[model samples]
Target: MYAIVEIAGHQFKVEKDQKVFVNRLATEEGKKVSFDNVLLIGDGDNVTLGAPAIDGAQVSAKVLKHLKGDKVIVFKKKRRKGYRVKNGHRQALSEIVIEGITASGAKKAAPKKETKKAEPKAEAKPAAKKAAPAKKATAKADDLKKIEGIGPKIASTLVEAGIATFADLAKAKPEAISEIIAGVRGNHVTDTWPKQAKLAAEGKWDELKKWQDELDGGKA
Candidate 1:
């Protein structure tokens, strides 16, 4: 079932088990929030749409948690004016777990209860963890340095960020790279992903090398 519920002055089509992030709500975690301003509802072929909002329509959701989003640094500067302003903001967010949608447009259930059970006590046993022998460093320059824009630090950053392969970098959209770059603004590392992806996609290593050379020569 799907329902269009109004949340934070915005309407959203929500379904069961779907997760949506919206404007911050003042409710505590695990609270039930019902949206009465249901604009539309659909159950298979049957669809109910309202003029402004459907009457007797509702979408029910559980507030899984409340958290702050990533810090957004706002910087304003006027060149030669000696005017500068810098501020950091983190948007408040409410992680809503859609429980269900009702035709009446009310949050259906009060909330599900959790039953905690006691664990059985037993005598503690010491478990030894042995360090495994280090494997040969199979990682090579071809594995990383081949990328037009990525240096060792950026490569390490990518690895830590869970991007491990040329295929991964090549397949990723520029916007995805932009998001990471946004996290660490002014890090020139991600600037070359486009060139790297282009080289990797076209299998043109020589062209990539020439391009890197041009960059090094300050001719780019």
Candidate 2:
């Protein structure tokens, strides 16, 4: 037989000899606890569900151990401004083993195991073919590369614009994109950017030699 019981503000269907992890309870390891508020019960073909909790129905479980979950890390940061933050956390948990359900809403059967006969082995099937390679994921619109005059300033503007990923940068607006790169070094230098962005959008990097030569000549 199996029954649904509420523990640690959560509901779970438990059966004989099953182990479960839940919120830390007041009971200690090796101690037995009986849940009087059973929400549902089932035996083979018959099933019963409770309104709030079943009447006189109870399920018993033994506290096996107390444990803690894996550590989780949280992080936050702000660009150029140099602001950063990080933290970690862990959750307490209890391990319990289901004992049995009583017919009179009390716990009855003893928790134990008996030897069983050996079962026959089944044949294994051949492995299936490998799936096709997935397409390259698209990145952001503000890809700094798409802005006409941008260089590293394109990257800086993207970050400042909150365009962290290529997918995000790909969605940037021209005016908004311009504003993000406004103060960076190259951006402050004559606006070689909007053209660079346009070149980037058309995949015309190979044709920029004349522009590069003119830029080199000016630097000389």
Best by the lDDT measure: 1
Model 2 misplaced stretches (Cα beyond 4 Å): 77-83, 103-220
Error of 2 at 180 (Å): 48
After superposing candidate 1, which stretches have Cα over 4 Å from the reference? 105-220
How many clashes show up per model?
Answer: 4, 25
- Candidates' lDDT values, in order? 0.59, 0.56
Cα distance off (Å), candidate 1, residue 50? 0.9
Model 1 quality (TM-score): 0.45
Model 2 steric clash total: 25
lDDT of 1 by residue, 1-220 (tens): 8877778646777899999987555455788888766766777766765544554667788989766688888999999999999977665566898887778642222121123222111101100111111112124213655665555655554543335567666666555554433334343545566657568657788887777776741124
Q: Give the TM-scores of the predictions, in the order they appear.
A: 0.45, 0.44
State the lDDT at 172 in candidate 1.
60
Candidate of highest TM-score: 1
lDDT for model 2, on a 0 to 1 scale?
0.56
